[model samples]
Target: MARQKDAFYFDGFRRSADYACQAAKLLSEVMHDFNPDQLRERMDGMHALEKAADGVRHAMMDELVTAFITPFDREDIDELGRVLDDVTDSIEGVLNRMYYDNVTDM
Candidate 1:
């Protein structure tokens, strides 16, 4: 049998998940090596990652809006994307709090 291509946009969802994992990892590293002095620089890096992830989600959504047939339910796909974005946002929130509080010790 010939291999079938992924009809659903599962790869996009997977990519978003991967981004969330990376953001979480970065958050852990920042906390482990907490350096108030470098907080701004570290945040810049995190923002870049977040922005890239957002780009992926947006592109997916744009495609989804015009897709006639999707692999999964549209609601589920949208929710998945939103949740992934939330994870990244939450991690950034924690880092933001730490930075604002001048948390020097992990």
Candidate 2:
């Protein structure tokens, strides 16, 4: 039972990482087709993906904190969750900076 729970938690972390990667891909595509008019829409899509990733990360963290017998160190699980969230945040920061800087070219 503990192994199964650990697997489930790991799976959730993997899914969140996947979502962050997908969001980064979408941002890359948008950057390739840079246009001020479409920036908001593109950013919106990226934000949605980031939110989804964050949701999964938060769920994992909550489970880790609540579980009396986590398969791994609780701190490690929390750190991994934070890293997954930071991936999206880093991407978002780049996009936001570009938008604010008035960068019209890719």
lDDT against the true structure, per candidate, is 0.82, 0.83
Best by TM-score: 2
Question: Per-prediction count of colliding residue pairs?
Answer: 0, 0
Per-residue lDDT value at 5 in model 2: 75
lDDT tens readout by residue for model 2, 1-106: 4577788688988897898788788878877877888888887888888888888887897888778888888888888889888998888878878878887777
Residues 1-106 of candidate 1: C-alpha lDDT, one tens digit per residue: 2223233367777888888899899998987887788889989888888988898899888878997777768898899888998898888888888888878777
Q: Which stretches of candidate 2 lie above 4 Å from their native place?
A: none
> Which residue pairs collide in model 1, if any?
none
Model 2, residue 53: C-alpha shift (Å): 1.2
Residue 7's lDDT within candidate 2 is: 86
Query: Judged by lDDT against the true structure, how good is candidate 2?
Result: 0.83
